[model samples]
Target: MAITGTSSFSVNSSPVFRRDVTSASGNLKRNLDLKRFAVSSEQATTSSTTTKKFVENGRMWKKSGEESETARRVNVEESERNGKSLKDYFDEAKDLIRSDAAPPRWFSPLESGSHTRDSPLLLFLPGIDGVGLGLTTQHQRLGQIFEIWCLHIPVEDRTSFADLVKLVERTVRLENHRLPNRPIYLVGESLGACIALAVAAHVPDVDLVLILANPATSFSKSQLQPLIPILKLLPDQIPFSLPYILRLLEGDPLRMAADNLVKGLAPEPTFGKLSHDLLTMSSYLSVVADILPKETFLWKLELFRLASAYANSRLHAVKAETLILSSGRDQLLPSQEEGEKLRLALPKCQTRRFDDSGHFLFLEDGVDLVTVIKGAGFYRRGKYIDYVSDYMPPTPSEFKKIHESNRLIYLATGPVLLSTLEDGKIVRGLAGIPSEGPVLFVSYHMLLGLELYPLVTQFMIESNILLRGIAHPMAFKRLKDGKLPELSTFDTFRMMGAVPVSAANFYKLLSSKSHVLLYPGGMREVLHRKGEEYKLFWPEQSEFVRMAARFGAKIIPFGAVGEDDIAELVFDYNDQMKIPYFKSIIEEATNGVINVRTDASGEVANQQMHWPYFVPKVPGRFYYHFGKPIETEGRKHELRDREKSHELYLQVKSEVEKSLAYLKKKRERDPYRKMLPRLVYQATNGFTSEVPTFEP
Candidate 1:
């Protein structure tokens, strides 16, 4: 269980870790070799047909052509379509059983899809296991974001910790020199995480982003005091049982395998295949003794002790932006506590807690490192975050997870979707809605923006349209001290295609022929007082009409009602202002963000942060109405007059009000508008079945 191999002890001054590697890399050079695969993205991603090889076990691991790579991917995909399950992971590691001897080297995993040329270089520092394939299942996905290099410290390789640091630092320095604009990523697990921190401490100036999973930097010898002796006393026959013991430390294999099936029930054949795979994978687990023998186990334990101390000392000098992934159920170390300490010690740090996950997070079933990175807003091609370009859309799996998580909201509030046709006939479903081009949907902000998820999620599900919401500027605001606002909470907005409200962003989105969702009422509408539900607090100006005309976009006025039915705003901004403590915190948070409404006039211009508390009512149905699309296509030139454009703006506003009026009146006629009837209907049908609303 000792995660000790990759941890390096380094002082403030970067320790020199150079050694003559000519003998070790001779076999690599003699075979077909060119630039040791790719050090970073630009160099690594070349013509698709060309072979990319890296040295593994004194052999050139090569993929000759596209056909072979495609076939390999097909087989891999068929075996584990969702992701590499626990069984597949064990099967992949079976090769380590032979106990072959070799030196530490880099391996570039094969990635089928095309990736950007400017992708960052991601070097994975191994845990105590030393077999760098810990990211085995994640390689294909990570390959799209990074030109991956796995540091494999051979089982019997006697390389010192300092020397290993030197070797990695050497590669880092060389890559940074070649692609000065690109940032390098260091992904480490446990002992590997400590090594990554050591590198960051030594090379503080390099543009490095560290993703550490259960770093052992906060280790205490007392924690391992009980297990050390028992590990050393293992007799020769014990190696056969090593896999059983290690699997206990690793995680529950059956539970891990079952995680892959969480989406739904599988066919009998699938379960039968899973059972067969489990038996096959068990034989691979027996290779654990070969990978980490009793002698090695005892050595790693002592090494882990030293690794912990040195890594602790080096934390002060680390300047890289760090993301610590801590597991709540980690049996090996107090990773959750270590993550907190690291967050406080490091200059810029963020921690993500996987409460249900094990110590080996990357190997776990539910964990997707790439999705985690996106959600954290840590994935970047260069130095600064270009909120628009660097934005990664939700993967199919991510979208599914998001939808299923919010299934309750769907069940509680049976949404009534109605759209206007060309003839002005309102109909159910979005059949009347246009699918083409630069479309702008002007909307009202439901209570605390409760209508957002249903609106956006439905658009994505029903029409395959991603409504890039024009989010309030506060969501993208930075702190006064110059540190970025916390990533964990706000970055999800970015991941879901929410751009900070700006004229420039609007223009860009329109120019790209995208569907832009805008809420003119902004903060004032969402945070309005108790009785102000469904009221438009929009500023009186031609803000977006002219811009929509410039792009000849279709402006659709949409309204959502039923916030009052779902929750009652028991406490609002007026109520909070009566209390000094809540009032001051609200003012401070609001003042920290840049002032956007300084020159604007009216009640809507009083833009401020308001944390309104709500008390849930019996769930009621939500009703949505999309009015007839107003075309600005050929009117671009005619609407140039200030009076003409302003007039058009008022027309759009009236339509939004009309839609609101339509939904409010119609929702009352629905039979299952209240919670009791809806629940009864769902009980008869299915929890996820769409409950009927009022006839359009």
Candidate 2:
């Protein structure tokens, strides 16, 4: 027999069945007794027919005057048993019943200190369960910051995808009227994400921002599609219940519930140590099983049809600024692929892939998801402005902070001597370099880009200019299907005016007359294999040279030698690949993602490198040398010639090599070249360590 509510257990007699029934029944009875007694003391509140039905079903009805005496007796008994008040048990019981509801549509408004008529409204759309109960953790936390509203669709209601869209549109309009000037943010999870997209497309001039987590766009193509055919064959009213069949179809309901609970409670490092809540597990499984049998055949068919329709829906109408949180570990759908598809279709879209999170990303990583939302400029207060076009350059205060932090690294790594070449002669410090105009510093990347901290900071300090470094796309992109890497460095990179290496961004920076740093070697240089240190792995194309000539930008080729001083390469990519487990991990991490080593050719092809494998040794001094500037001014015509551009590229590459050679030779003659002398020198001098340099 199908379990409807708490009353269904009264009909079951099997021993195994009795245990489950008794657990839920006992809890309900204890709670009702406590609640009935409380009601006896207080005046009876007005009750609806639905409340009366629930009371009758739970067997909690009582006549008028007897409640007070019964309540007093129950209160005394409850106090003796647990020394807790009747109200505490009543609340717990209420929560249990609330959670046990089949296809729950209940909404308990969260109290928020910042909630006001003017606060930005956030409407949350839930997954296929339609329960809208999983995001309790998110609601409690985010509600304090933004006005939160969760959509609850009753299981009995037959709402089409189009109907759902209309509902969302109407809700957003109502909220807009309440706030008037504030923007609305539609947050969707799985199926809800698809609904939000459809709503955004249908509603014009709504000015909504979408935050979608593990959207169910690939539901039609997923493994769940096969089950639809089987569901169709089943009779509308079968002789026996289909809960066991549904459980098998669902695949390990207990495990699924346990996984979600564990992830929600103790994420990442504390992953599996916590014990599973058997009560919660029972409730979750029972709710799903109960809802499946009750849902009409037509409703089940419509659900599948709606999902299929949404999978193939046109997304071009979605013009709102959208932030997609695609979980890499999502098993229910191909979230990463779907996110990319959506990103391509939408005009303004940013997709972040969470490598470690599953389909229930909001439940597992709510805090990080909220952090990403705030970072996307969706939660700004007071004024409403278009943040997409607003370039976030570092303020003077930020610059000072970065400068001071880098200063410590500079002092620790010995003195950072800045020099430039003039007429093929080495000139110490910034005196030889030009003071103005758009100048691009094309530098050879050291291992892990360790030279960046010293190079960028020293240039800014001495020349009073910030070097806007062009970074690898991976640096800005989230880790694919893995735990979040350190975000502080990425944030710092952005604040210090770092942009992904793109021709469009490069042109924009040059047009603004800013000092830009370019590393043509890219990931090839950073993830270089053993014996590839200080080697240039530049691509054959001379596109940057042609672009630089168009803007009359000065190309300053620079190089540094210091990675070898700080660490030694004990293992390389070949060594990593030899181990089967390690190889699988590397492949998983880089699946469908492009890296320099993925399809390397020429000098880079010979390296066959992966991520850098190094063992730290005693730290030694770092050396940097800048080559004479190659003026691209009035050389646009020369750069336009493919042969001339190739020649110019060769000249820049040669100059960078010269700087590397100069530093390598000069560093050998320096007194602080070895770590021992540098440490001794620092100890003797207390705060400062002087290094003797040789003339080049």
Candidate 3:
């Protein structure tokens, strides 16, 4: 549920509720109410319909929304959950707890939204609450790409932890057998995360992706230590334990919810309004205080203890690709600290932290699971993730978010953009570049690739174009050695459609007629020496021209200069190599990083990953110029000839150098190229006003 919305939404009492229990491969035998979690925000809604036919014990039950009421349910539910809020989850969970259900079952929410034909099966295992409805906030977005199934372990059901694992394992095995090629996603939270891990441990060889939020594996060391003794001593009929249980869960559910609600709110917030909402929410949670009464509460706590022990013991056996989402303010567990520990423990694992979030990370207002998966480049259709195919283009909201995140970078290095049309007329923005597909922008990578944010964001904001950057493998690959911490910055790059650099990916981008951003100079230019600023360290051979010509891509040779203006390289890769300590660190860091240009010599082949220490200067402006697009439509056959390809490549390189020189020279004439003048100009006018740049 998002706390941030334009209009208000309220959860009414006496809402519809689904039947108490379900059978395995659950059918709607009870004419259940199957309550839909309604939205408490004004977010836009979208729907999807699952069309795959089912084969149950050789009997074909072809249930599809295309010809049935399934589609209607999807529409109705999606619209209802358009902007799910914390209250919706509480309401649905309250309904589940109130119903006297038995046994654990897997059920597909007919309204789980639609998915692609090749969408992998995503089985959600619920947290301690055991309703499996924890993903209510993320249901609509997750539905867009995953065939969803949710595991419901009834609050009243006293299923042992081992049996729970068996049930999930059985479901995983059966699904894998049916769709062997597709990777099943195990989206788990807390206790559910433990179940997912145990299943992964049991089926080590199976293809699976685990997305665990606030995993309870660290429960043994949490503040819940005192609860274990109390839980064991409590009698079955101790109805007075709800407040104690809630206390162990967190300090105060109302306070926690209220504190996190105003975070990331839209259109700003007033303290007075939030205070009123906080009071109202406090009353709401109190109304349903005993959702998990004595017996069920004790059962969940015991399950957590057993599941944690079970999963932690077999950590070595679990081989599935795992993403751990750790919340910083998680009072129930030390999730933030545990994330770092888990990253080292798992063979194939990565962790993303939400410092402001709590134990119920998924249920929190600001968290978006789908976006996190996409940013982490975890979405895939088959056994392997093809960065190019799995890349999800950023939505308007995402683009704006990315821009705002890097806004300081923009202000720190004020960017001035210029592009040339086919007629050689220079324009202030992207107006001169062709607004079409298959356009390859080959730019000189500025120092540390500092120009990237400005370039990518401006292209999206100014020209309404998305630049699919060909990036380094470190952005996509996880280094198991833990020699260097994973680059969290790359998450934004992946979110903005940056694919790992590879010959195949380049071909895929061009073949798909997508706009591609390439840095032919690669890391050689990005992490250059003290004196190599604005210098092109491109490969000796024409690696990209032939491929670009084959696909008839428009190669736009561009240049961005001004790294020297913002900072001076006090220590570089060359300097690091000279010192023994730094050299060892570099070797260890790049040990697991992908080897690029292994057979090549010269500066262009130097693909070592190292951060050059630099000293900041007075903030200066960055200048970018895109030269005229070199047409390759009719020159494919011509470029197939080696001489022609090399000739064209050299021509592109020369143009890039020319643009660099042009920007270097022209910026000298601009009065507001430096920070102080630009600030003064904007201050005199409006801070939101665009400071003037050199005349195009």
Model 3, 82-105: lDDT tens digits are 757656666666655554344677
> What's the true lDDT of residue 236 in model 1?
58
> Which residue pairs show collisions in model 1?
none
Q: Model 2 segments beyond 4 Å from truth?
A: 1-389, 396-412, 421-425, 478-489, 592-609, 679-692
As for model 2, its CA RMSD to the true structure in angstroms is 18.7
- lDDT, candidates in the order shown: 0.71, 0.59, 0.75
Higher-ranked by TM-score: 1 or 3: 3
- Tens digit of per-residue lDDT, candidate 1, span 54-133: 21111113455543221111122221243555554454444432344556766554332234457788889987777776
Ranking by TM-score: 3, 1, 2
Clash-forming residue pairs, model 2: 355-481, 355-482
Q: Tens digits of per-residue lDDT for model 2 on 455-565?
A: 766665666666777876555554343322433346556655577666777887777666778888887787777998999989887748988898899998888888887
lDDT ranking, high to low? 3, 1, 2
The most accurate candidate by TM-score is 3
Where does candidate 2 have its weakest 10-residue lDDT segment?
A: 49-58
